[model samples]
Structure formats: C-alpha cells, structure tokens
Target: MRVDGLQDLATITRQLREQRERAEAEEKARREAAARLEAERQLFSRAVGQVHPLTDRNLAELPTTPPEPLPLQHWLDEERVLMESISDDFDVSSLLDTDDQLSFRRPGIGVEITRRLRSGHWSIQRQLDLHGLRVDEAREALGEFIRHAHKLGVRCVRVVHGKGLGSPGKSPVLKGRVQSWLVQKKEVLAFVQARPIDGGAGALLVLLQPARSA
Candidate 1:
C-alpha cells in the first residue's frame, strides 16, 4: 500500500514538472514578442524627433485651372466628312502622261500652276529625302508625307529622290516612280521638276490642295 502511494506521488510530480516546463516555454515566447514590439516602438520614437530634409524646396506654383480639353468630337466629324468626299474611283488616266523631263498635274490644273511650282513661287513648307531607301520604303514614305502635308494645309513640299547617280545603271529610278505616286494621291494638285538650286531633276516640288473644313 505504501509503495503504490509513493508511485502515485512520483507520477503527480512528473506531471507538475511538465506543466511548469510548458508554462516556461509560453512565457519565453511572450517575452520575445514584447522585446520586438519595444524595439519597433523605440525606432518609431527616434524617427518622430528627427526632421526630414525637404527634397523639393523650390517647388513650382500649381496651376489654378485645369487644361481645356481638345475638340475631339468636332475633329472626328471633320475627318469622316473628308473621308466621304474622297472617291475610291478617282480618274488617274489624266495623271499617266510622262513628259520628256517627267512631271505631272491633275486634270483641270492650269499650266500656270506648274510653272509657278517650277519657278519656286510657292514656299516649300516641308521636305523628304529618299536617298538610300528602297522602292517599297520610298513609296510608303511618300504616301505618308503627302497625306500629312495635306492635312496640315501645307501648300508646297519638296521631295528629293536622289538622281540616278547612286542607282544601278546610273539612271534615276525613283524620279519617275515618285511622279506616278504623286499623281495617284488626290491631295497632290500638281508637281513639277525642281529647279537647279532645289535638287534639279533629282527632286520634285509638289503643290497640295488645302484640307477642307469640317
């Protein structure tokens, strides 16, 4: 009976020891968490006392009013009307005539216009050079140039299609092709061979029609 009582006492003592160990482990974890929180609080307190230097001391004054929006709806309407006016079946037959020097003018375009263009009467607003570009590249460039110039109301522009000096067989290839391309575009009213000072036979002075209003 005494031995059994002693055995029960030892088991109870072991359970108590395990309980204490667990409590110690939980207490250690809580202490560590509290230490971390205290460290963070100290860091924040130090930052609160320090003054940060201003990076943008010379800041510009802000505008009082917002920018006015663009007239997007009006612009789109104008563009649609312009597109409808252009006919897909435009007669290019009149543009096919090739003179000795190679120049073209749309039908109904007076000879005086061509004469003025050749004589540098119209101011060249923009110029494009297709010196080393291939045929496909040159074609795309010319199309974009003419379209953009027409939209911007540019009346005169110069295109330098470098004389056959660098081309194979020493013949100007783009010189004739450029004329053909210009004739196809409805925006181009007339084109004449440039004068000697303005690239001569190597380039063309094109007169563009003014863009229609909305």
Candidate 2:
C-alpha cells in the first residue's frame, strides 16, 4: 500500500535544472549571434570604404617602438673620419693656412713647399712592419723608389718607411740608411724630417730641382 503512490523530489528538481540550463544556453547563443553580426557589418562597411595605405602618419590599430638615437661621440667620430677621407682624395688641407709662430718659415721655403705640396708631391704615412724585410732588401727597395722618383722628375717626395721599435733591443736600420743614401745622392736638394701627422721622423721629406735640366 505504501508503494502504490510515490513522487520523487529529486526528479522534479533535476527537470527544473535542465529547463534553466536550456534557457541560459539560448541566451548565450543569441548574444554570440549578435556579436558575430556586428563584426560582419563592420567588415562590410570597411570593404565599401576607401582603404588606407600604410603610412607613418597614423597608427590607430598598430603598436610601434621608437628607434634609438645615435651616440654623440660615435656621430662626431664618423663626421671626422668622413672629413679626413675627403681631405685625402681632394687635398683640402692645401687650401687651409695656419699662421702660428712655430709654423712660420722663410718666405722662399714657404713658397717652395706650398708649390710642391699643391702639385701632389706627397705620400700618405704607412707602416712597413708587416713586410719585415732585411736591411739589404729595404735598401734595394729604396734604391728602386729613388730611381722611379728621379725618372718622374718629381721635385719633392715623401717615403713612409715606418719607425722600427720591435724586439728587445735593436737600432732601427732602414731609417738611418735612408737618411744616409739621401745625403749621398748628388741630386738631392735638401731633406728634412716630417711632422708627426705628416709621418713623423720615420719618413723623410726630400726636395729635388727638376733633375738638373738634363
């Protein structure tokens, strides 16, 4: 008799939960559909609108990082190097004049040196340590240079035979020999040591006079 009529509260509660879940799922689906429709509308409007080419002017939807500025010292060094390169090719130093007392010379010597310098009687300073040739070999090479320079009737010339301060103890060989050979040469007008920037004492600035009109 007790089992004849029975009602389960758990079954009733389970049915109610399913109905609420279904309603919530339907609401969520509607919201998703509305969002998708809005996105489609926006895309269609953009397609109809004039498209903008990428430019530096505006960045409404993009993120960008700023570039780093160049360092001051590096920028200055580059500028100096560029000026030096131009000077090497164009001989711009010839146009400049320094009027310091130390730089003053006899009017006659000034005129001569300026004329020769303007006429390209100069050579850039260079190190010959890499060659590592013996004194005899260097003497031979120097003789060849002298011959060639004399043949050219070059009034003035510079030879950048480097300062040899290598090893524990040794007098620089090429430097002395070069000076001696120039002294012995009858054709040599005068020779003087060069300034540091010009090649220092390692190089000699030799002057000649048009190979004696022969």
Candidate 3:
C-alpha cells in the first residue's frame, strides 16, 4: 500500500511542473509578439510623417456653360463670294497712267485724283500686309479688306504686297494681281505706288469711294 501511494505522488508532482512550464512559455511568447507589434507601429509612423484631409472650401467649381459656336457656314459663303468677285484676267494697263509709278484711276476719275493720291491727300485709315501669304489667301483677304473698308466709309488704305525678293525669279508676284483686282472693284477709285516713306515699290496707296447712305 505505501509503495503505490509514493508512485501516485511522483506522477502528480511531474504533471504540475509541466503545466507551470507551459504557462511561462505562453506568457513569454505573448510579450515578444506585443513588443514586435509596437516596433512596427513606430516604423510606420516615422515613414508616413503627417497627413491632412481636404476641406469643402478647397474644392474647385466646374464650368456650367458651354462655349459659343463658330459661324463656319457664314465664313465659307463669304470666302466663296470673295473668290468669284475678283478676276485675275482683268487688264489693268489701259487704265494706268504713263507715269513711272504705274498709278491707276477709274474712268472719269481724272488724273487729278491719282496725283492727289500720290501726294497723300487722304490719310491711310487701314493697312493690309500680304507678305508670306499664298496667292489665293492674299486675294481673299484683299477682297474682304476692300469691301469692309468701303462699307465703313474708309477713304484710303495701304496694301503691302511685298517686293518679292523670295520668289523664284526675285519678281513681285502679287503686284500685278493686286492691280488687276483693284481695277475690277467698283469701290476702288484709284491706286498709286506707295511713296518712299510708305514702303516704296512694295506697297500701294488705294483710294476707296465713300459708302452710300443706307
């Protein structure tokens, strides 16, 4: 009986020791995991410095209205009419004076008008520079300018059709064309080569008829 009691006591002592050891190990593991989690949180805090949330006042408003549409068809019609009104085939030599400037005066306009134009009797109200423009472009622009100026009662204007030093043969390309175009327009009364102060051979001083009362 005494030997059996001793064996039972030894087994109970061993079981208690094992339970204590397991509890100590679990506590150590829990502490180590908490320390690691705290270290990781500190590292993240250092990397992300600081942050700020945007407020409603900082937001931008979007545009509520659409842009105006272009008058594309109207422009196209105007360009077409301009193209048809002026002719490149019009002969201007018969209308020009025999002077060195090759000035022109409409029928019944008289040589006095050309002389007045050459002497700058009328102030140049507007000027169109056709340098570097293609032939078709220059023609359209010239037509539009002349019609507009005549409509607004502009008496005189300058048309600069560059001396054409850049052309294939160093000849002025738009000079003859401009003269012909001017002769065809009823609005043009006379045109004289610009004087030395106003671009010399590279431009013309044109006189437009006063606009009729509406």
Pairs of colliding residues, candidate 3: none
Runs with alpha carbons beyond 4 Å of true place in candidate 2: 1-131, 167-170, 212-214
- Model 2: how far is 45 from its true place, Å? 99
TM-score of every model versus the real structure? 0.55, 0.38, 0.62
What lDDT is obtained when candidate 2 is compared to the true structure?
0.56
Cα distance off (Å), candidate 2, residue 31: 99
TM-score of 3: 0.62
Off by over 4 Å in 3: 1-84
- Output the number of the lDDT-best candidate: 3
Model 1 per-residue lDDT at 5: 79
lDDT of candidate 1 vs native?
0.83
Query: Which order, best to worst by TM-score?
Result: 3, 1, 2
lDDT of 3: 0.91
Model 3: per-residue lDDT, tens digit, 167-197? 9899999999999998888899999999999
- Across residues 8-76, which tens digit of lDDT does each residue of candidate 1 receive? 989888999999999999999999999999999899768788787999899888899989999999999
Cα deviation in Å at residue 73, candidate 2? 62
For 1-214, candidate 2 gives per-residue lDDT tens digits of 2333236666676888999999999999999999999998899777788776677766476447866776999989778544432111223222223432112122245656744543446652222221377756765565556556776777666766557676336555566556555554545555555666667656666665465565
**Poorest 10 consecutive residues of model 3 by lDDT?**
51-60
Least lDDT summed over 10 consecutive residues: which range in candidate 1? 84-93
> Cα miss at 24, model 3 (Å)?
99
